[model samples]
Target: MTSFAQSERAGLCDTFLEVGPDAPTLCSDWRARDLAAHLILRERRPDAAIGMFLAPLAGRTDRIQASLAQRPFEELVDTIRSGPPKWSPMALGSIDEAANFAEFFVHHEDVLRGVDPSARRQLDAAEQKAIFAALPRIGMLSLRSCRVGVVADAGSYGRRSLRSPKDDHGNVVLTGEPGEILLHIFGRTAVTDVELDGADHDVESFRKTDLGT
Candidate 1:
């Protein structure tokens, strides 16, 4: 799965290289190149040794992301495919690997949207779940309070929300094949065919929030 994801990430980067300089991306202020630079930077962070020791004080993901955004695209890609950072921990578990996978998958989609819309359909179930699980951990799921039904289908796993939480302000009936819903919620704005309710602005606002936007 990791190998597949890395290949996808590389493919996404190649797609971005073809984007015109004037093209816009989901990241409003960023051009396609800027987004590519950011992804590359993300993969090039200091080893886990330095990260674990100093991350508590200076390892803000946003800061790290911003710092990466400043580099040139080619340099960033070279860093990502290179061997793991020297200080990285040796005993990373499944969850950590999942997190890494999610990072590349989500950002790949984000960049693809701006460069090549067709790239969105390239994702598989394992990649989708890794993205789904990772988004919430990074605060992407906290976009808005809506009483929306959520149905997810990924390979053999399927789940549906039977009851809306009390805090929800409106109802959004999100029912579809699991992978579709996963794609919709995780930065795929083109999934307009999926069911949605409440004010369009609310949904749009949710999309604009810091979670993934």
Candidate 2:
């Protein structure tokens, strides 16, 4: 079976090429070319990739990404479509599956959903399972700073605590298909359709929380 990672990567690259370099994306201020450069840098430039998590290094990362953005658009698209070079750690099978599945899935949506009057993509069970498998880590990464508790309830698949009640704020249980939950976690809350069950205050806060890019 083709892995979700591989599927999403191909889809994302195709969309990037189809849309061309100047097209808008859901990612704030990023055009198709910019997004392609980002994927390439994250996979190929280990030293610069650290900036993704380090605020101090972000400026340097941005400079490098901008320089890369100036490369021939077709070359950038080809690099993204091909994925990480053989020498990179992400080139390993297991690591690539773990890391790229959600990355490419989210980015694929970023391109597709950015268009006017966008419709949600139809995800298969295997793709949903891939996103769900990464939920614990994604939940912690995106929601750790929020004041509400998050339980990603993937029925029959299992329930995982994304977070505990950070304060007196009520706990919010997010029950939905893994793809919807992934959209919410990635800060596309306004466009996502998921069951948000909790106090109004908590739900509102959760929606407003800066969940990152």
Best by TM-score: 2
Clashing pairs in 2: none
Model 2 lDDT, full chain set: 0.84
Name the regions of candidate 1 deviating beyond 4 angstroms.
Answer: 1-4, 18-23, 40-72, 89-96, 116-157, 162-164, 168-171, 176-180, 187-193, 197-213
Over the stretch 1-213, how does candidate 2's per-residue lDDT look in tens digits? 667888899888788778889988888899988898898889999899899999999999999999999999999988887877989878887888888888888888888887642568888777777788889888877886789988888886678888888768878899888888888888887667778899999998888888844
- Which residue pairs clash in candidate 1? 47-87, 47-88, 48-87, 48-88, 49-87, 152-178, 153-178
Point out the worst 10-residue segment of candidate 1 by lDDT. Answer: 146-155
lDDT of each: 0.50, 0.84
